[model samples]
Target: MEAEDFAGAAERKAPHGDRGGEAPRTLPREQLIGRLTQLAGVGNIEEAMRCLSEYVGASRFMLARYDLLQEQGLNFIVTSNWPFDLVRKISGVLADRYSRSTELEKCIALLQPSFEDLPPECRVPPGMSQRYCSLLFCVGRVRFALLLLFPDHMILSQERLREAALLAAYGASFVEGRSQRNDRDFELTEREVECLFWIAEGKTSDEIAVILGISRNTINNYITSVMRKTATKTRSEAIAYAVRNNLV
Candidate 1:
């Protein structure tokens, strides 16, 4: 906290670095969208992100796919301007945490932007914020997370960030060459989740029928559908799947 310390910091600062005193330029959301769309059209994730970094005043960008069922990180990743060792060390933690949620939580999280802190070891330029803005989505059986780190003291409009989340989904789809990851709810129908919930509560099909004012056969059919969709052989197995996936 000495005056010399502040002077020393200024001496070390480079022009237009992530934390340099000079402010980064901001763009209109419409213009940003148009540019990202054009950049993404080239079918290059890195290229789109290179432009994104300049706009967001961030040092890096990363897209990670997480497998919620397996509790592991998928092989898919696109990053710019990040250290290799840092990515390797923290990618798993980042992926796991973002992808870890119940079916209900996933349902509510759609397109909702949020922030999280990185590990202390993940270095940025002096005074750059260590926070990451995350946007999560799902495709078929896979879940994808887009992360961006903004420079310290720079104010980014949340409106633009939300649009960035949606556009990032498109960019990811373009890069992965597959559209639709089976939808964010994993294609689980409402009645199916209801059945899964009741079963997880130790309810027998007959009891559920009485509570739901449906025939026993209909309740059995719902349970059957849940098992088939989840690929579980037994009611207990199906319920376990639901619980593990945070569905119930």
Candidate 2:
């Protein structure tokens, strides 16, 4: 979904519980589960992005998957704001520097949240602005982030942040398992299942290949086979399916 679409959607869903601009009531655990369950069922990526966008009360959100290789930068599974050109440019810039910060390091190493000040390498083009942006958590092998745009300094309560993180984690898992069966677990080879688990943890294909002692192409092939068996279109969908089915 385009960033512009967020404003309208927020207007429709907003004023629900806002106290002088803060969320009036934090989503209860049951509500959160319901929302995430709904998200798991979304067939369209935009619908999922929009679901996440409103849930977090953010003007924009992005789920970008990064590989450790110096050359192949980040991949955008879903983006709410930040223009395409900017995302490409900033992703390249952020790739090398992410490893330096403790938050980024923890996020990459242990699937933790990197919710800190924006990395210096993230360059906003002329006329662009943001207030708070954070790497919330990683799901499987993907890093999911929450970016709050300018004029909206969302001082997320620790409880709310924690809850959002948990919900985002669920979303990550759901996206990670998107193409798996809804009723039963998809039958995947040992390597494919291993790859699926790590992908949910945000590992790159090369990482999986190395861990499995196989070529990257072979790793990709396994993923492809899994996706075919599950009948998913994108890797995100496959992961979502896996999450829904509790495959990994």
The estimated TM-scores of all candidates read 0.56, 0.51
Q: Quickly count the clashes in candidate 1.
A: 5
For 1-248, candidate 2 gives per-residue lDDT tens digits of: 22223222234434332325656444556876776678665634445545555555555566554433133434343545665655665565555555454644655533322343344666554433443445456665445554443334233333344455666667667656665554335367677777777776567899888878889998899889888878888887777776546565
Clashes of each: 5, 32
Q: What TM-score would you give candidate 2 relative to the actual structure? A: 0.51
Alpha carbon deviation, residue 230, candidate 1 (Å): 18
In terms of lDDT, model 1 sits at 0.62
Instruction: Return the lDDT, model 1, position 49.
Output: 68
Q: Compute the lDDT of residue 155 as modeled in candidate 1.
A: 51
Residues 99-137, candidate 1: write the lDDT tens digits. 466657866766666676778877765656676667677
